[model samples]
Target: MGWIKNAKAATLGEDARKAWDAGSPVFTPILNMPSSNAGLSGRVEDWEHMMAAVLAIGWRLHTWAVCSDSRGRPQAQPLFVRP
Candidate 1:
């Protein structure tokens, strides 16, 4: 089970890197919530949701850095690694 999660995380990381290198937005499916609940929630916090999702899947936030996108907009990119 742990190995499977690790493999998934590794794949996701690779895909994210490729997208980032191509100056594309990295959309993490795990962080997405149902659109219908958007109004009810009002606002969604990123870090909180990320932490919850990663922890639930037996992973941890190894590190993060501020990276620039294609539009030169700064974004905090988190790297998740297996614990």
Candidate 2:
């Protein structure tokens, strides 16, 4: 089971890299929450779902954002890391 999780994480990293290179969305299913849910309960439910998905995968997430600097140079800023 541990090995299986490792393999899945490896595949996920490869797929994420490909999507990043192609400028495509990598986490489509998990990210596509309905915008109509604008209540506290709805938000909590959504958070629970996302947390479950992340924990089940057994992989930490490092978030990155693409932005431009003062000189208009494109750069990636890493934020909100979990280990």
Candidate 3:
């Protein structure tokens, strides 16, 4: 199950606008993959939805790499930038 496939553009746009207004680089929710599949699909889906919205509004993906969470757990944290 994925939300992106049925996500409303207007809703996504609103989220994007909020992030843009915040004036900080947007980061996707931490993604813990093969090590743990729990919520992986949903996280990926949300990431795709957010990416689509951001790109549509002139934001670009500036970084896509692994990062450690607060607990030092490995995960993917994609950073988006505007410009």
Top TM-score hit = 3
Q: How many steric clashes between backbone atoms does each model show?
A: 0, 0, 0
State candidate 3's TM-score. 0.46
**lDDT-best of 2 and 3:** 3
Query: Candidates' lDDT values, in order?
Result: 0.49, 0.41, 0.60
Q: Write the per-residue lDDT of candidate 3 for residues 1-83, one digit (tens) a residue.
A: 44534464456566768878788666343444433344344454444555576678777778789766666655676666778
lDDT string for model 1 (1-83, tens) is 45544555465555555545565433343333323334354443443444454445545567666555555544456666554
Per-residue lDDT of 3 in model 1:
58
Worst 10 residues of 3 by lDDT: 27-36
Query: By lDDT, highest first, what's the ranking?
Result: 3, 1, 2
* Candidate numbers sorted by TM-score from highest down: 3, 1, 2
Write one digit per residue (lDDT tens) for candidate 2, span 1-83.
Answer: 44544554455455444545565433322232223433223243433344344434433445645465555544334332233
Local error of candidate 3 at residue 39 (angstroms): 11
Q: Give lDDT: candidate 1, residue 28.
A: 40
Q: What TM-score would each prediction reach against the true structure?
A: 0.41, 0.32, 0.46
Clashing pairs in 1: none
lDDT of 3: 0.60
Q: Select the stronger candidate by lDDT from 1 and 3.
A: 3
Candidate 1: 10-residue stretch with minimal lDDT: 25-34
